[model samples]
Target: MITSAVRQALRTRGDEPAVLCLIGDLGPDRAELAALRLRGNDRRVDLDAHGMGRPVTVEGIGGEGEPSSVGLVVIAADGLTDLRRAVTVTTQLPPTAHLLVVVRHVPAHLGPLVPAPPTIDEWNDLHELRVRRFGNRGWACELCFPGGMSVAEALAAVVHGPRGRRRGPGVGVLGGLSGTQAALWRPGDVAARGVTATGPVEIDRVTPVSDLVLRLDDGGGLPFWEDVEVPAVDRLATDATVAPEVRSPEARLRVYGTDPVSRVAPVDERFVNPIGFTKKTKGPLGELVEVEGRVVVRDETCVRIRPTPDGTVTENDLERVRHLRGVRVGWPEHGDTATVRIVAALAAGGVPLIGDPAPMWAAGLGAPLAELIAGGAEDVLLDPLRREEHSIRLRRAALRTHGVRTRWRSLAAEAGLPVPPETRVSVVLCTRRPELVGFALAQIARQRHVRFEAVLALHGFSADLPEVDAAVAEFRATGIPLVVHEAEGEKVFGAVMNDAVDRASGTVIAKWDDDDWYGPEHLADLMLARAYSGADVVGISQNFTYLEELDLTVWRGYRSEVPSPAIVGSTILADRVVIEDVGGFRPRPRAIDSQFLLAVTRAGCRVYRTHGFGYLLRRAGGGHTWNVDLGYFLRNHTEQWIGWRPSVLLEGVPAPFGAQADRHIDHPGEHVERL
Candidate 1:
């Protein structure tokens, strides 16, 4: 029987599917078996295809009193003719409906079209379906599942398999990976096409339990509807730390991050507060790096403050000092009382102040500006709003920096291996927005790490556009290997992206949105995280999506829920191998990222999140193919704070804010419903 967890996961309403029908000239036993296959969930109107000729039509089934309200169509295939008839009938289905095909055998001629299961077609005497695939869209049926008698019993067999069945005496693959996932999956091969099976094995597991490769449920097992690959972020984390390492007593911490100052214009009112101006606050820059020598290495975040020759604290410079990732203070040569009180203000605000700036001196903190005055002159820190908003933000960022620094130090000390594996990346850019594409292409060029290539898929008019041609020309001029794939059609986001992946030669495939801000070190950091974590996909742990029109920062869930994770986000970098196994992205245009993430996870591939890459996601308002509209975002997402970031003003795309996206205005507290 399925365990409680599996049951909860596969929860069903048990209502009759809207329209269930019998297709082709089938025996009575086939229909009964189909109903029995559904068992507890059986509620179908056996659509009698009485008068429907060779190529069955939806109209023919409805005329015979079958409920024409189609939601699902179930067909039992007895032979080659039945299969072809079902394939044809499916074309008439509403785009949203699903079709279930129960096939005893597939026509050998059609074998090439299917990524048919290894040698399953060779088994002539089998009584049930062994593998499944769609002609082009969505799921079709396999009536019978792997290694079980009937459909229901096959589903119940999922959680009953024995785990930790390893050849070695110690523990199994699950034992190597310690977590809830390990407990749920067994290390040994559970299915007939086991990991060790000869012939075609799609992808090998890095570690047995971590692999968790799921086959397409052809026949049975708790709704084995799709093949899945769940990424093991936790496994990546543990493996990174525990892997064997060589002695490197003096490994220096490398500084890798992109500053937001160049992108941000000081003119925006949001950056200019009543007391001071603001610079973007970066996260987790305070990781420990091994520097040679054992001279009392205390902290990674400490930064020594540098001042002007005159040594007087400026009004705007206070925010600069606050933005620094450390707390240890080192006075300038021409130090004055003003700089002292700025430290005093920071200390009074509960920001940690340390006695020594050992680590700080090494990190180089120099210069000052007018952002937040370090001068205790006007006592601007006394302003209640300033104190509530600015001070809290400063304190929180400093604390997080301190915490990350400490954690890294501990990890570095415990790590067995000196380094992790690095995978080459191929960034897939599929878009109709030429300008944004150019901008994204430029940003890709800015990445510090050069172990990558850009595979761009331009659809519709973009393929032939002159401006796009020039941009492509310019990118190739830089000696970067750029490959462009073009198709003439309306947008299908998933399909286009999948096409790009098919052309990519990199070890990791990075999915990038047309419009988003990524720092120069973005690719480097993602690769570094991938090496250190061994995660299938590495992305920034946390990200914020800003609405350009509303000037509001939107979030769907807790801003802090994902901390130091091992997966990628919408702009993701996934293992090219895993992408192949999961069949790349889905076919639809809308909600494609969501669909991709779900299918990959279901296929037992791991998605892990890493520290931030100075990532900022943007929503340009309505006309967006996906769900990030002003109304949808405001209604669905929780507002983190009233904040805005620099605009992605780049070349190939249109006036990004105008024709590309729609905007909604709030007129002095206008009701949302009215808008």
Candidate 2:
């Protein structure tokens, strides 16, 4: 992937200089550099003289102003007649840019004054190998910074005794995570060794886009010079942390962590967790055998990880609980259980966690480790260390087992339909926006689960809705039955949908909103979830919406991994009898879906949630959203809705297409009806 990325970078650079070798004031032969410049785009600049510890002045040759920033910096060690000038130049480059240091031999002169990088094993031979690959037996050996370190750090690596915070706690954390490549601050000069260490260190800055910033000391202004190398799988937002507490089966376990009971669980009445958390919600794994299975799971019981009689701990224990959605476990009775050993090993490696109990507590496994995870006086007890540990090993295994990369074709097999497409399902699509009717119709035409008819209900008359009627006429060629309903006067959104449902002659009536988009397998997923989960009304309660003004795709409901009494809205597929039981949708200008779902729940209708199977609610500044507070709506603290990945209820289904932010749908292809 890295090689391909580098190649793509070269390709995209076009006519720009691909390799700029700075050889003192003149830099590597300008003529050679010019030829090295990647194809077509003619963009080049020069840095005549560079100061090692100081900044270098840049001259922009093109119309572009003195460059705001640059992407790469290359320095030749042999041309370094002045060490101070070299130090100044590298420090001035962007923190994010890549740096390359070319050398004929290891420059021992700069080692003591600057931080040393990881030792280069057989540096001469390695250079010879690369030089051969480039077919340029040039007398220079080049050193590229590993893992995209900041240019500042790369320059520091050229010098003497500890150039950074050599004594602080961050050193340890950085040491543990880097494995054998950790160049840390120890007594004199820490060498790259596999230091196994773990503890809770404080996070100085949660810079997700770049560095894993840490606070090395309790005093204000902790060392900013060093950073921890967070594994890609272990990285997570500051707010997202795991809180696990062990409890006796009879201990009356409420919601775990800082999650509110109302939001996470049905609260004896409601469902769904507050944002930034999860509650103990369980459902079938959806691993169907031969035929699809209709499974119902309301067991909110947290999986208990108890100590063995001998109080032994092992990797096997962690694996045992790996598949569980939520878990509760006490500290292993044996003082040196596998959990304790893992934490100790990580601490020994210099990777200390950041949280309430502090690094020392975890370093020693002092008292009960469960206390660390259960320390939620205000909110969730965020144990990032424990969560990351699982991701580093366990989650990757699960991902590898499912070798199939997600795509439309692979997803088709995953969508395993419980019943064939010939089974009729009615989609009551209500729309007030004539301009976007084509968009809605386009999605309807693309649904992979085909045994459905479209009941296109336009709120206004045909005279005012020329665009809608035009789309309708265009779709007439498609063989799929599309029953058009043109309301004569202004009608409420709920009334329009309810009237369509009344007129539709299918056993299943699916509610659909015009602005919302869906995956081709959406209806199929819903129908399967309803069939297998034994749900009276099944749909994606985890409503992922696209915020048009913000240009962001977001999920509103809290519990996205389990079932809850969520306002599933348009994606809901209700049995005709269930709709009648709820007395149909109450007609109002707004909050119609919410009102109807509430009625359904109150009337004893079973609402099952599905995963991200493409029920994208397109939220804009105008329209029905006027009824709610935008801030609260965006943050999603407003309500508790229960739902999980559609794959949980329905077996063998990949994620819905538009569920990912980048895979967002914006097309309304030819609306010609399929015959």
Candidate 3:
């Protein structure tokens, strides 16, 4: 029966699997049984019996050491007699190895052996009687789990107990083995249930759960799906601090007064009125920085006034005192009353007591002759406006100063089109200055290893510049392609640049000015920087310096060598397409680049900087530096501010200096929208 069972088990294990029949004998019969099992079945089965004596020894079980090649182990009733021997053998069976045992029909020993009594139907072989133990053994036997255990409780006990058979000492056995057969599964047949867990608990609309697989009628399964109520939080306030740092330490106090000589009250403790001036003040100097003050006490020849709480006064206050009526001349006119005492109490601050001399002070003073002034000064009164003109004349004589100059041509250049290409570019030259045209075009024609191109835009050209015309012809002779064009009339600078951009033909387009020059390797290094950064635009710094008066000589010496930051605005390297998509530059006549730059940044393009010589922007008579027309700039500023519109500036470039950038304007796209 043992031989039949071993053979049956070997046959069940289809392959040429090693079958270790760990019985108490290893004699020739055991070898023959192994060979017979091997021959009778399609699989090769080797029977390695543990002992050859009448009784199975504990030491015999030691041979079962992790059956590496063995598929199963057959433990006969005789071989399992020694508890220690059973353990040793079972322990040696590798985690994956299976065990099957058979026992004789010994009624007394079999009753307590198994948890269940085997029924007649449980035995497939009718010749072999079926037997089972009684009571719940706190674990389900193989027979109780024919369709697999519905719950983990019963199996847990058997897998956790001291011996493979004893689940709990006092637990009631669910079933028992009768006086004939033994239990079936091998040591390796038992599997461990995996414990799985989800990650951190997320308090959101959907929470995570594990092990629950929902099956649809179509045989598909949803491993995880969650539905839960989630309270909404304020998005703006979520990560924001309720109280931010106050940028201005003092409150701004606006005290309105129309009169030029109005006595303004002092400001509160934490604040100070730093200035006093007319609302619609004219003239550049006063419109921005001019100030005025009032005098409350005046004597016949001087003025006595309370000093500011700070105990200090500025030159402007002294000038105000000097301009006051009935006030006599004092070395320092705004602070203290010592000068007033010298002029006496008869006159408030020191002047002729009879006449309102404020008007007289405004007129030419001292040794200058005014025919009517030969009589008593009080009798000769002048209108304030006329007095102001005279005061200006006197001040001019007293201070020995000249008036400010009005006309200025900060930056001037020729405007033209930009020729864009489709290949990796070695250089991009933008210019209008006739002097610089030669140097920039020559560099492009002479560049090696990388392809080169030029975009010469002539702005404000009255007549064709002879020098620039010659340079263009020279560049053409060298076989280097050049695109020369002029700016569209009646558009802002931003618009002018946008028009020039239509002609760029290179993948990596660089910026150039009519007065700017470049190093030989500038284009090569800029292209490399573009590749490494994976950016749409890269900027190089150009050193700024004042040039000579001549456009040509002035243009040649200016250099824009970038500083610490590699990225910048005015001078950038990028693809031409980026410029076209951003609607080009705005038509703002003043501060044209400023508006366009803002637009490019909003578009979401990467801006980087390259470490190399970029270009030289001449800081000479180049009228481009200062936006001479304020009205045009304000118009553009208002357009951007009100509509929140972006300027059609070049995109994909960084404006490193930001608000401080003067002549050039570019924008790095922040977010790009796919068309």
Candidate 4:
């Protein structure tokens, strides 16, 4: 990948120059390899692998003291901090040099540093690799390497082979389906089934000419098949209204879900419009207004309702409404397809508020949907304080229950087709602080909606201690699997983590810190983000922190719900396969998390950062591996409270031991000396 990227950069420059300045941290071996490749092409390469803020100068090609202008510059950043330093190098480069910045992992939030958008070549959790270029015209796809194909073979094919379309099975649709609805069907499955027509297709008539015939229904009554005395069609119904003759165990209704694109799109924090209603507007009781000849409505909060036309909500439509805090949706009445689609679109897009979900009980989504409904749009939806809180909850629920793949998998199972097994996670907790063992185990025990086992690795301590033994017994009583590994003399944090990972038998592995607090749905939310984003690793930002010394809580303004190069080390969750692919964590004493992320990104795997409302990082005096001081967090915090005030997602979670007493500190200034 690096060789190809360098070749492309050189080709784009149009001409060779005196010197090619190589900067940033690409490790010594990679730097040498890159230099060797360039030398074979007869290019003069100058390496600066440590990112020492060196000036790019043509030393060998120019006069002894005269500063020579550079021709091509390539920066290789290892992590987010290194990426920022690499961006600064562009300012120091001469006007003649054409700069190309290459990072092993590209973070979602690049900030306002880059002059233009950088092109990205990403490999998803599936083996497929896609190259995307961003310019004034937005993102354009260059190429896609299919799954199970080696990268070298794909590159060679792109260079020499003819670009011919591969043929597959044919599918014929009898009725019109919205783009959102059409996206639910996998391309391969649709091609395999010769006819995927809407309900009422005669089975005997179509099955003779086609390999497979699938009849799709929109939850409406099967009026077309009402006259047929013995309907022998293989059906796919969205609701519980199939014909009695065909109501076998394999013919049950499977509730379909929202489009996948909406779930992966970045959430826009700046809310220009407060309330939005798209495609359907039957039950949103509000004052009507006309703006630019378009229908608009204003509720009691004076928040205007931006309504889209009564049609299918496209991908572009979902992207546009990403900034809206609340989306007003009508009840999914029986057989009301428009309302159903609207609800799903809003839910998957992470819209904070949705409404009138009383009628969704018949649609197989009663409890989760009811939790997100707005009782009164003006009262509940307009509350600014709870909007972000609601968004976290709604998006988490959508990932666990309403993903398109999950819906399709359910349908495939009911039809007696093959389906993938459910995902199981292994939570790895490594700690030297034996005092915090019970606190950590309690948090792990509260997690829900995921099949997970906890692997506790005690560094420089024994699990036989009274406090550790008692916590282990309490945690085991919850019926969850637990494995304890004692590293009595091991000092390296990274090696200890690797030992814990080796003991884990789960498909997915999550790292947990002993001193932090996590909500019940933390692991479930990470799984959901991974499913929709197709990212190899998924974790949360360190948005919330509790300063144990000063008895204060700080909330940082880090951007969540996007793809970032790095996340908080404690909240990291990744597939076990990717972990092994990257050769596990580096066997170092410090910066283990950052180094592991760099390795993953260098291997062309994506790292995604989801919402951090459920996690609370505790910063005690100074014994932690991450040795940043309390004052640093205080300086970067967007908001602060006197005591431990976590987000609403952590409301039911019990406070850490002795945290309840810190709530009585009245004023934080009294504990200023402790910092």
Candidate 5:
């Protein structure tokens, strides 16, 4: 396969640096033909053939520690006999290799002794099988069949004596049919896959320039019509009507007579296939033995007939049988030609099939194959651990099967831990644009059902601006007790959050952004979820037309069907103790918030999601964390914090004092000293 692909690729890349390898016994004719095909196509197809000229045997494939170096492998069905060897070759191929396989359907064996529409007694013994060879190969196989000659010739139209000197058209029935009358179109007309004149009354054949065509209605109770192409003739059987009804069980049939045809009678609905074969018993051999069997052919439509004294298996007592179950038995079209050819070439070294064939087989083949494959196995081997999918699914299952159970609030309540009824809720916000501070404070003041203290952390600037001071003064005048914390140090988001948590005297702290507009019922939802989970942290996911349009602080609670926490970021944590215990977040710019959530979650805290619009994240151009590649940072950060790796923390964001931020990686001694 690799050799064929390489040869083909070389031919297509004319004059390019190309190489080819042949393993095992190389057929003289095949090799010569391939060489000729490649050479004639272009100079790039230059055969720089390599590998042991002596046939590379199947055993040599993926030999010991050896790996075949090939860009792409094409396994044509012509050379293969042993499908297992082909699968093995593909399975062992390197990660970068590409593979292609071609498939061809073979005819099933129904013994010559028991002809095709087998006798009731022979139906069970003579099985008509459709072998889906390589039934388990995961490789995509393209099935191709040869198209017939020209359209008219393929349809098999009758021709008259001569074009110029035509014999009188054979007299035949001219039957017409039409669909139900409607404003425009109706599907009342019948079409057929293939049709034949049923009861023939000879008609004169006239040679026309092309195939004759007709569109007419054969008057019947139901409005019906047909578009037909049939050889015209005289002396047609006009006594028979044109049957314009074609069902899978019966074909649209027409009879020709000496006069214009009368209405055509419908064929029995039980008769499948326009063309059929049936034989009636002639001797007492048919009466003594009851013929009771079902024809089981793959691909073709078949009928099952059950036999009884009254319901002796007859042509009329059968129904279409779709799928059949049996061990397929047959050889390729050109026996051992393509199969032997494909197998011989691929056996030398076939591509290692990607993904497990068992599950894929079960999926494609359904219950029968799935049960067969898993008859005696521990479990199906899914995507290997090398794939992110395997690990992700496992993690998700773990979280769902045994979810986080926190002891903080429960233990506190059980141990009669003191409850501060007057506990305040602290709100924190950060913004580069100070002008938006007023709106943020107004929303905070509007929380009628909640009591909370708000803090605005403005970005540190070398020189104080009048606008900043005015925005601070404006927010303070809203009658909402506000603290304008001077963010003078280097901008580290985690550090800023820690500062707000430390300064506020609140039992629960909620995080927020400055520029985001809040939903009126946002605070109420958080309190409700926190009360329900009885946990320190609450989480939720945001629903928005665009991610940037979402309020980062609030989110509609997670859907019940989610089975897991949705938004890990927009969660509320009780007090500063858990936050302080979690080491107060790494001061690095990227993934600080996500990293904090991971720590809280790992610490056995319950996170609940609220439904509806939570909070929106106001996107802006520059921030120490946002300036660099945020996606790259978050992906690594998640892998490190969530997947566990401290070294990931050391790979700090490219920011001022990014190195110095490590000093704050560990919690303040004073905070931990009390814990």
Candidate 6:
């Protein structure tokens, strides 16, 4: 498809200078093949495939030396990152240059080839590409090259011809599967089944005027033959046998999607609104939908319902519940698969589901999540505090069990793929308090499902201190690697952290706090979020805080699991390369976490905030670098507990060493100083 596009461009340009810029994961072998194919047609076409940072020379193809202007620029990109690189290269080219962008996997929603206005950096470039509206030209799909048309003909239609008429919103089904297994799926669902699926195709709304409509009868009572406009189906083709009466001979179907799993990534509740919606004034209840003889509540109120249709819930249904504060799920009679899928969708978004525990547990939901399921709608609907607490616990369960990555991992295992290797993490703990060293190391020791090393940076203290030596010895006995670094007393906090990081050897680095409480699966959960979200940095929100002086545990309902500008400093876990790319930790005495997050964001790197279920930040009187007062946490808290009540996800975590003594310390400032 790429070679044909190139050939057509050459035909139109004639003797004009042309350059082909290959970007992304297109391997050297594929690049060489593409170059060879282009050159084989004509010896005059001098093309060399270069990596993004390298310069491309259009020597003999354009002129004797480097040509000042090129008539045509072909950019073939593999993914979003490559597209950003293409955008950069386009800016350097002549304004009059005819641009052609070929993406291997075009997002289903992109309508045209015209790129959005470029941003100041690559991260913004990617964000723009994701959310920007597209026009009807400038991009072509390698997968959906129109059949029976020459490259020149297709290019003319795509670039110079009139814009294609926009189809109605909803799915335009072209073919039918055998027997009663016919399922009306969105583009993402089809893509997950290894078929090329495209669209913002709404399954609930399909029009007879749709170019390639399929007649679906799933044996359910719901109306399947209703004539409704399915707006904006760019193109879709399925391998299922075509229905003779509905098939259009001239109408070509093209489906596009990144992946089925990735389709849910945007809706992953963890990454949605991190701020708690509990404090907001309640709005009027919205429309309600009935399914399976039950009133499945659909409203703008605090408690929403995830309406399960007769069959599987469509992508549109998922979108409806995406921002919901809490979802009330009722038993769906639609088989086990549908039930599991519905729960997964709800849980994946970090939204708490209020339903009977028995059904959810039968469907394989384990503890904490099962515990979160309310006995009845009235249990949480009448109490905002109960709902908010449930949301926190549910978010934690989502990270550990219901995440998209976790689901895929389970599927992969069922298919008999080899288990993936555990991610290696270097825990960097920098602190001035010698008494809290053992307490912090104990938290690191409890971490599971990851290979970890401890890098203890004793800021303003010597390693020879008995407390420091004893903590190191105990941690090393756990068989995990330990590296101790002692920074001079005068060193800045950020400088001390960098020194410790320098001595660490792990693919990923996790910043640890000496005085904070962490769950056993904290690092593992961060790893899961990292793998699924593809963010440069991952961290938990500072949701749970223990006010030592007041003997109160405050649950600050901070938004989590979404891309944000910043996350709690100590909860940060980032790949070493990403940290290095952003120039490591800034050399500052205070607010280094915020500073580092800012630097990375400006560098076009993503910062993802995962759940705060496993981490509990400690706030004593003065002495801390964060320096926020006790009342600040109290003011923002959605709920408060009298004793030390962390999320159930932290159940397996051991109690902090010297917990009783540390609680009654006279010099709280000297006893708990985080470097």
lDDT of 1: 0.38
Number of colliding residue pairs in model 5? 79
Task: State how far residue 446 of model 3 sits from its true place (Å).
Answer: 3.7
> Candidate 3 or 4, higher TM-score?
4
Over all chains combined, what TM-score does candidate 1 have? Answer: 0.38
Candidate 4 regions off by >4 Å? 1-192, 196-214, 217-312, 330-335, 354-365, 375-385, 412-420, 654-675
- The parts of candidate 2 lying over 4 Å away from their true place are 1-422, 463-466, 555-557, 636-675
Question: Which of the two, 3 or 6, has more lDDT?
Answer: 6
Q: What TM-score does each of the candidates earn?
A: 0.38, 0.36, 0.28, 0.59, 0.29, 0.56
Question: Model 1 over residues 438-540: C-alpha lDDT tens digits?
Answer: 5566667656544788898887755456556666766777777889998667758778888888898887788776667665556765554443233455566
Evaluate model 3: give its lDDT.
0.32
- What overall lDDT, based on C-alpha atoms, would model 5 receive against the true structure? 0.31
User: What does candidate 3's lDDT look like per residue over 1-675, in tens digits?
Assistant: 545655666677544243343332322435555556353222221122221111222222225562233344444433222221233223323221334444322222122233222233533322222233322321112222222121222222222221112121110111111000011101111221111111122322554321111111101111222222211100011001112342122211221122211111111100000111111112111100101432233433443333222111221232233333322232233422222212121121112222223233222222221121222242121332222223322322221111000000000000111122224552444344445555556545554435767766665552156666666666777777777877645555655666667676665566655444344445654554343233456675322222323221111111111112334345566666666656776776655444545555667655544432234333343357443332322221211122111211111112121122222322112321111
Give one digit per residue, the lDDT tens place, for model 2 in 623-653.
7623554564567432222322211112222
The CA lDDT of each predicted structure is 0.38, 0.39, 0.32, 0.51, 0.31, 0.52
In terms of TM-score, the best-performing candidate is 4
Candidate 3 vs 5: which has more TM-score: 5
Which digits, one per residue and each the tens of the lDDT, describe model 4 over residues 453-498? Answer: 9999999888777777877887888899999999956568889899
Q: Specify the poorest-scoring 10-residue window by lDDT in model 1.
A: 262-271
Residue 558 local lDDT, model 1: 23
Q: Model 6, range 201-317, lDDT digits (tens) per residue?
A: 234244321222222222211123332332221112221222445554343222222233211211232222222233222433233334544335466543254432322232234
Q: On a 0 to 100 scale, what is the lDDT of residue 536 in model 3?
A: 55
If the candidates were sorted by their TM-score against the true structure, best first, what order would they fall in? Answer: 4, 6, 1, 2, 5, 3
RMSD to the true structure for each prediction, in A, is 24.5, 25.4, 40.5, 18.2, 33.7, 15.8
Candidate 3 segments exceeding 4 Å error: 1-422, 426-432, 462-465, 542-570, 590-594, 612-617, 626-675
